[model samples]
Target: MLSYELFFKEGLYNAEFIKKFTIDFDLLESQVEPYTPEYASMITGLSADDIVTTAREYATSSGSMIAYTLGITEHHCGVNNVFDIANLALLTGNIGKQGTGIMPLRGQNNVQGAGDMGCLPNQLAGGMSLANDEFRARYEKEWGVKLNPYPDDTQTRTFDRLEMGELKALYVIGENPLLADVHMNHTKTLFEKLDLLIVQDIFLTETAQMADVVLPARSWGEVDGTYTNTDRRIQRVRKAVEPHPNTKEDWEILCDLATLMGYPMHYHNSKEIWNEVRKLAWEIYGGITYDRLEEEYSIHYPCPDENHPGTFILHERFHKQNPDIKKSRFVPVDYTEPLELPDPEYPFMLTTGRRYESYNTHSQTRFYAAGIKVKQTEETIDIHPEDACSLGIQDGEMVQVTSRRGELLVKVKITEQVVPGLVFMSFHWSETPTNVLTLNEYDPISGTAEYKACAVAITKVS
Candidate 1:
């Protein structure tokens, strides 16, 4: 089989690579040899014996599922990491079948839906690229509006633009950038300079407190809408109670704002908006109506018509439908060390992630009784017992963790969960905001910050 290593060796990314090769899966597989378990063990930290056992088990199994969270996508090489996952699945023939798939566990409830509806800066609804002439034309005809023919700057670039005075206004919805953004000090400076900062959310978040306008929107229980889950299941949410006296539903507020801005958005209710969404992206959402949702509870996307059942596993007849494009291609990537490394001055590696009790930024979770009881009110840094002892820090003692950008005071939890040279923290509390110490460098393709790794130095304060 043509292994990815052979594909790279054949000058696939060079000027003459495409002209010299064809996209034939069988031909390419035959030209290259698959890597042995020992080779994989060299790159990953896993032992060769464990790797061999895992390889055997996976190959022998009828179906297997691979699931990962931000751990796989919160690095400088995040995009390539996802590509590596896809390569593994394709090589093992473990996709597009029941009981087998590569699933990304989203951080939030509707994150998958947001991507499908084209919340990305580079694409329109349903991930239709503005750069694609055919896709752009079709969307323009369907929406009766002309979209920018070029991709817009990503959220990272947008912040840079705000700092540079290139952009003035920022309308934030359901996000608390002050507490959540990498390099919290820098993010604060950028937000302060914006001529108009509008925040729409259920609570007065740290970011919302700084905004010129804070529009109070109804919470989940007071709104009626459809939510798409990580598995692409479209499920309906009904109103359990009326909205607060001062608060309006998110859609109603948005529509009223649009009307005032001369767009003339006159939707009577949430279902009217749903009908419009169905009309705009019929292939994925046509059969998913509120009535159908009441009957079936939920339906996965690619539900083309009312009579059609929702797709469970995707790509059943993919190769048959598109002989050339349906099959997978092997793209080779090289591993690079993280941008920041442990130096003599900052001789510790820092990683940040979410905890079971606290969600991102704690905009709402901190208010929950269960979330509060699961952990202490303040955030604590998890450090190895060896590191804590070496640094003269005891468990429950306060420590000052400093990075190149900024620093924060967090409590020390001496545990063996982390390695000797590494420490971990979650950005759940304002008292010990971990983002202040995180580096601002992000993945070039996905524009996601490198939150998984950075260099830091810690000093015991107590």
Candidate 2:
């Protein structure tokens, strides 16, 4: 929407870059014509003039980047939202250069690493598709076992299957679904229904407490591994102190479990496991050996050979190297309203996010005394002063917040940070469990739950 406003209205786009690198320029212009500044302003509540100014600034800037978090993805139209952002970047040619490109700020330190290692159901290592015959055959040959060509169930699908009694067991690692997942009541119920629930974590989290078998895993300071940051930089981590006698390294525990089963995973240390990763996913990790990582301290991916330097900026030479190939395309995405909207009954919109002092679900942060004392001792719903005044609610007052899914008692924080008819809360407190009020609606493409937007009613507790 903003890109179209910049292109047709303000004429503030890189015509040379668009003509050389992209396709479907005419189609994109036509597709986005209807999304005027006024039209977008109506939906987003930002003034038309402000939207136009923002578009102009973004287009005219020498180098600009869009960095977003779960606020953009935790919606029913999350995938489309991302496409829209990418379209804007392509429209203004603000990508494939220094200080430019779209960046999704990962929530955790190693989320990028986990995804690169094929944590997602649909992808194999190095972002390869599971349905790709060549990729599947490579994995099968390397592992000496027949591989399932089809993609496995995602987290949302697994929950659906568990509700229907199809999935009998679950192995949770470093996650607290009871506090983190949307519709917490339903998630807890599904976990209870599971025949075997194994939770592996350093801390005995709320989810771990319910597990039939809880495997104690070593913490970050007591583990030797590589952590890939949000910028795709893989840095090695060394064990600082000895681990507890009962706890074990996450991979060692998994290897032991695998050995107990039919398959035998004869691995020694983290280096051996990393070497196996390099062997299997040569395209991305081929040159990223422990030796190189030790010598260089850190390196980004796409280092296909030992001598090849890591990729600093992606797609930098794509247009020059692959002249015949179109570099990118503008994906036209129409704006869609959130799944749930504020009504008379549920007169406010509740958006959930994280606090600086506390991390997701407060699994690790809560253990630190200094962090807890410095900021965010407990969870509180942040409401606009207008909403609080209208309801005769005071700051720090206990309130009852209810949505269709569930209700919880939380302290109130009257602030102008949030707009009228909108409230904000963090899902960092297990006691408050803000996800109890979150909706379970997910994006069809990404399967990310609608955690950012939900309808709720907040009332002062008598």
Candidate 3:
């Protein structure tokens, strides 16, 4: 809505970069015109003046950055939200330089590493597209095996396939989906329907307990490997302590399983596997060898060759190096209401998030005595005092929270932290099982569940 006023009238945006690199600027302007500050205020509850001020400050600032976490991505319109955020950066040219860009904070330490190593359903190492013929061919030749041209089902779709009896076996590693996934009751049912379930982890989590075969794996402190941090820095992780007598590293377990299944993986150590990765995804991990890391300690990726310096800021010289390659495109997206909204039946909107005291599903943090004693001993719902009064519920009183999918009992903490019509819960306790009350709705493109927003009804337990 303020694009013309800010970009043209006030001259706040980067006109030169936009004209050269970005496409569909005029279309994006038109698309966003309907979404005025007033319209946004009605949805977000922030004043129009505040919105305009924030926009002006963000656009006119010398350097601005936007960092978001799962709160933004765990929504039904998660992809659209990301596209719009990119549109903001593209509009103001808040990218391709120091102290300017969008960053998605990963939930776990190795989440970035996992994605970079092609852990997604439709990606090769270094985030190369599996559908791309050249990328697929390169991997197939290196591994000496035929690669699947088609993309596999996402986790959300895998559950659906399992429920329909299309998928028979599931091999899970380090994930406690029974407590982490939305609609917990449904997830449990789907797991029961699977013909075979194999779980590999350092801890016997709720999901592992149900697995037909459980493989004990070494923890992070006992593993020797490199971790690609959120900043794209590939740093080595050394063994800090000896692993359990029977436990093995995750890679070792996988290799042994593969050997038993007729495909032998003769990787001697983690470094050998890392060498293979450097050979395959040379463009990203090529220059980041273990030897170089031993000297430098850490280095950012896009280190294509041995002599090349590591990249600190991404796309800093992309347009300068290759004028033909447009830096990025503007994707205009409009706001959409959440999949499940508060109604007469479910009068409160419940959002789920993580607490500092406990990690997701309490898989590891539950073992920490300090974390348990310091804060978040158990799961509790946060509700506004007004809502508590209206419902005849007191602070610290046990209450039953129900959603369309399932229900759970949790203690309430009445405070002004949440609005009258909204509540908050952390999904770190298996006893409470917060995901049981969450909706199964997901974004079509990303397949991320609406864990951030769901409709629920809260009442005092009798």
lDDT by residue (1-462, candidate 1, tens digit) is 112443334432222222222234444354334544455555555676776656555544787778989988999899988876765566556667788779999999999877777788887776557798877877788667788898898898898789889999999988998999899999999988889999999999999999999999988899888888998898988899977899988878888998899777677888887776677667778788899999999999888788889987786653234434433575545556789999999999999998886778888877886534565577889999888889988899988999999988888998898978889999889878899999999999888999989999999885
Q: Model 3: which residue pairs collide?
A: none
Per-model TM-score versus the true fold:
0.89, 0.96, 0.96
How many angstroms is residue 76 displaced in model 3 relative to the true structure, after the best TM-score fit? Answer: 1.3
Q: After superposition, how far is residue 222 of candidate 3 from its true place, in Å?
A: 0.8
Residue-level lDDT tens digits of model 3 in 81-116: 888888888888888888889988999888999988
Candidate 3 wrongly placed segments (more than 4 Å)? 1-11, 318-322, 370-373
Give the TM-score ranking, best first.
Answer: 2, 3, 1
Candidate 1 contains a number of clashing pairs equal to: 5
Question: What's the candidate order when arranged by decreasing lDDT?
Answer: 2, 3, 1
For each candidate, the alpha-carbon lDDT, in order, equals 0.79, 0.87, 0.86
Angstrom error at residue 207, model 3:
0.8
Score residue 26 of candidate 2 by CA lDDT: 81
Model 1 lDDT on a 0 to 1 scale: 0.79
Q: Model 2: per-residue lDDT, tens digit, 1-462?
A: 363754677677778788888877787788877788888888888988888888888888889999989889999999998998988888888988898999999888899988877899988876667898987888888789997888888898888899999989999998999999999999999998989999999899999999999999998999998999888899999999998998999989988999899889888898987887787777887898899998999999878778888887887863365667556888877878888999999999999998888888888887786534656689999999988999999989999999999999999988898999899999998889888899989998888999999999988889
